[model samples]
Target: MPEPAGAEDWMPRRLAARRAVITGAGAGIGRAIARRFAAEGARVLVADIDSGEAESVARELGPPALAHAVDVSREESVAAMIGRAVDEWQGLDVLVNNAGIGIAANTPDTGIEDWRRVLDVCLTGTFFGMKHAIPLLRAGGGGAIINMSSVAAIVGVADRAAYCAAKGGILALTRAAAVDHAGEGIRVNCIAPGTVDTPWIERITRGYDDPAAARAAMEARQPHGRLVSPEEIAAMAAYLASDEAASVIGAAMVVDGGMTAR
Candidate 1:
């Protein structure tokens, strides 16, 4: 008879045994992913523009987590972040491209600078992260990449022309990467979330004339009558990173509380 699998032989076990680098991990969905991956036994490199917050999260995750201050929009910064991960972890296996910004201005009123800034962080940042990450992933023999897109990529929202364009660009980028690297044992996918109740969303609502009303309207817009949680998005990221999701490539998973159902 065939021998039974050892305690550690199970697939998808010890997810944290691999090494991962996540951008924007100082807060929101990125922070949640960092926590989850650390819990799963993966050594995590938490990279964010906010150095203090990144260090705090890394400390909270204890020994296996490393923190770095990274501006993903810049090629050199992104290259350094990826290089640090390889140096610290010996190699990199997973990458979560979660750094992004939101801009709330109509196309006509959106200043050239604002549009450029939003695109630089949201779209160009993702591109740079992917560019730097692929070599490491290839060196490691293969890996999974999760790009954080948004429901905005699928549907129109007012006063967010730049944000929408950047997210839409991410979806296309995700698809292209998946195809380009499939032969190299790399899997690429995107997650498009709805109105998630992160600090960013809170800030957006707080600026409204009726903050409470605006918050309620945001909730009401979701078919679930609530905003998506950072943890929920992190859960999806974990699944995608696991071997169980080996065939889930070039796909855009929507975690939007059925917002796109209509």
Candidate 2:
């Protein structure tokens, strides 16, 4: 069985006293990151398009966490979300641009709308987050930004053309931002996750003729023979958000069960 979530040892409080905003914190990887950050002593703004989910996650994290409704694809919404964090904490230490969606279709079968939607959320959303958050980070005397990419960005996955393209864009963006801001003490990095066992994966498999078989196939393709857990990705985010990663900039940290190794 996969090991349970969280640090194996005592919590290191790596992010102690940090102020953070995580997009899409209503569920899955975002939620996990919020929880982990709270455990590490950071106050978090749990922002999500789903107000209720965001509220629930914020409440779960208690007084240190605030829930904010946000649609990352919209510039105004992204701006407001970051503004709230700044108002609440006076500045920001970390921003996790984790909101994203995937459309399962090859380029030929992909509709224009679907392509635009995927890019809007996955790629443009990251762009918006960085655009709005960078100045605040600069004002705060430097901070960290963790953008969520995917193995799809590093290796081609059949029928995920839009996802691949958007995630690929994230890596390039991370590199540019890292270079642009590194001298200012602002570090930018991305996490390239493998197929994580999240509700999103379940939703994706439902479209398959045999959801079980499809999930199994996904697992088999991973060298580790299991789906990556959301918590694992969260752990990486925590590390990147910490001062320990002071020298780690423009890096794409892969946590994919060795999916790209094959």
Candidate 3:
């Protein structure tokens, strides 16, 4: 039988009517996630430390998508970001704590300042985001929280002591939060991606004498022989945020292309 005129399409809109906030959404993985969520019918708040970048992404997504400047490491900033989302959307349904930074240094070589900076943004920032958003999620009757961890948390990465520590903390936090809030209808989960081919990777590569060789070497380390794409991670995030993943709390969905299989 033919479909009626103006009827809904057969496509999947897994996140229809969801109000979501994605931090560090101006570029890379966060940007991809924001785009995916919007395409899936969710209204997104594109939050990032770079106001211009955030606004650009929000503009690209058109109406119902907003941009906010936020330093997720600061509790006050994180609070304001969440408050704005609730105010604009009348409630919150999804929060993606995707903001993070790293320092390239071994434990002994890593300075206290570098260590604190990485932890403050990568780990504590996630804490701040969840801390403020959870209350609103409860008020709205339930929601999903997706924390962006990394393969470094599960496998050792040379010259990334602070990053590894921060990501490891996120996994632990996700598990505890999931357990504590599952009864309240809230689901918490995480994504541990391997080296993603983002601008961040380009920057790291440029620091090497042979940028091409360095990038190739990095890709060779992956079992798939290529860095993961931000869009791949975004797809996983969309699943975790949608009703399809209602039973996926506390899970660390690895998008590492079998990086840990060996």
Candidate 4:
């Protein structure tokens, strides 16, 4: 893959000639990962359902970073996104399945539509990303796949029946994919994060009568009394994408400020 302009000096040789595809690249952890990967010399395809934000992020990263509107839940869309990556960057070396949604409906009150929507994006979407990305990675002699899971995957959380179920499925999916592909040189893993300070959390608290109280509740739940930053999660992601984490597979690295530890 060709190096983007102005990124020649700072790009790491380890990743300089590689290409990465990150879903949900419109904001938060996904955006951070795209920027970090581009800085390290990896050509990136920032895929998101929000085309505007995705394009903005890609432009900010300059050349070699392109934007594509992708609905990861759809097989055709995911295949197109992967095809674009291969066509643009020549080959793919990393896949970050970061697209997801969180629904707060309790199990009893959750509608079938809502349940399927959450599962479609968080679990099924991730599966599709892996399914489409595997062939590309194998064609390129193998690569890394990072799936974004959540602390809910490891623990039972209230008022998040669908979200938890989807996330839990992601944990199992990660392990299964890792075991099945390790011999083929593909490294599959998931990152389970606690409450990260992202727009998603902000939106979740917006309608609360006492937003402050709701925010406080979340903070109190974390042992550190604060939410994790997107950068912190991105640091771990960058490590996993690098050769440094060659042996890390089927692992769900947690970054929840000890929330699940309790």
Candidate 5:
């Protein structure tokens, strides 16, 4: 039997029934990804240290989107968060470790405590996310893990010693996990984004002596002369989680708008 004329063979949403857990989903890029995932019909668990903000984002997403508080640096919290997602959706399909912090200082100027804090939240936190999410993802069959790396991971930037270390570590873990889990039906990857137009960047620019000049300097870093949008990153997340990227594993997909072209 032939199909009806003009019948498009596709779904209205890309991620239907896909269970996803996105950390730092309260605001900035995390919030955008959560929103985008929910829009694509994924059952999302919005996890953040900020409980109120997490709830708000989940509420806005409607049913099947739940909110939870999680300190990603803590293994217990990460475990509980992942457990919640599994409990709600019956399993896990995608895990996006998007929570991170930055410390703006050179190696000589960065304090021990500052470096520890940055690594604890950015590097260790990602470790926790992957450690807990991988088992469930494997049990439910092959799934995707998207770590949020940065241009700092692949390039040297002034006044970003701690951030560079943590993000660079993420790149290492992403690749290692991809290798270790490829046989387990799990795919691990990462996104290395350039200067993005998020609240975090806005706060940095506003704190500078000349906001306009500071923002212009950031814009100049990327050849596109514009910051990447959170939604654009979300789109990448969608693709990585969907079957469309079945063969994309251990890839640090650069979403830097040619910032590292030089």
Candidate 6:
């Protein structure tokens, strides 16, 4: 059995004794969530499509931490991921569907294949995680599910037609899952972040004519005039995973620096 969180964990050890699996944990927000969950005393499984990166993160987190290569878009891969957790930890608890990508394309530029790819990974991938995880969670006496959404899910962003559509779909999926599973002690929620400072954003900005100006423009979207951090999102995930958020059901916790307030 995994050891209960010590007093030295982040956020006062909110997620003690929990076992969590975070997808796309190779880098960015997924990586932050894995680390944060570990710090809070949970044994984390760093799941990513990239085996090397996932193993690296697992090694970084040390004992009780394991790495697995999983392609969220594939149902078999997702099933294997959940199975590994239950097999290794003897049960399951929390799951973070954080693997996603963005394609710079408007409705016009969004080809059929492009749309399918975005939806497959961002939307269907979340579905696979939830579908396979729910049973294990119920067996383990219920747990929390936090899906990673975006500001685009709530509002709109130009040239992100496919991405926005997929994110928006996640909101609907989250709510439905929460309502269906609440009676079983499962709490489903999502974090809709805006302009988070992660490797993804850095890559997007680097493609711009002036990376600095691109960053400034991205930051300007949020009221705080800066991008949110991966650590910040992880903090909220910790709270959601804990019993403290027992009442927070089907809620889309917007940690977008008040970007949607405008």
lDDT of 6 by residue, 59-149 (tens): 8888888999999999999999999997899888999999998899999888999899899999999999999999988887899999999
Query: Which regions of candidate 4 fall more than 4 Å away from where they truly are?
Result: 1-14
Q: lDDT tens string, model 1, 206-260? A: 9999999999999998999999999889889989988878999999999999998
* CA lDDT of every candidate: 0.89, 0.93, 0.92, 0.89, 0.89, 0.92
| Predicted structure 5: lDDT | 0.89
Best by lDDT: 2
> Against the true structure, what is each candidate's TM-score?
0.94, 0.96, 0.96, 0.94, 0.94, 0.96
Distance from true location, Cα of 104 in model 5, Å: 0.7
Residue 101's C-alpha lDDT in candidate 5? Answer: 92
**In the order shown, what is each candidate's alpha-carbon RMSD?**
4.8, 3.5, 3.6, 2.5, 4.5, 2.1
Please provide, for model 5 over 1-262, each residue's C-alpha lDDT reduced to its tens digit, 9 standing for 90 to 100.
3322112345236777799999999998899888877777788899999999999998887777899999998999999999898788788999999999998999999999999999999999999999998988889888999999999999998999999999999999999999999999899999999988898999999999999999999898889888899988887888888888889999999998899987
- Candidate 1: the clashing residue pairs are 16-41, 16-42, 17-41
Lowest lDDT 10-residue stretch of candidate 4: 2-11
Q: What is the lDDT of residue 198 in candidate 3?
A: 89
Question: Global lDDT for candidate 3?
Answer: 0.92
**Candidate 2 clashing pairs?**
none
Cα lDDT tens digits, model 2, 33-121, are 99999888888999999999999998887877899999999999999999898789989999999999998899999999999999999
Clashing pairs in 4: none
Q: What is the C-alpha lDDT profile of model 3 across 171-239, one tens digit per residue?
A: 999999999999999999999999898889999999999999999998988899999999889989999
Q: Give the Å error, residue 11, model 4.
A: 9.9
Model 6: lDDT of residue 114:
87
Q: Model 6: how large is the Cα RMSD against the reference?
A: 2.1
Q: What range of 10 consecutive residues in model 6 has the weakest lDDT sum?
A: 1-10
List where candidate 6 sits over 4 angstroms from the true fold: 1-10
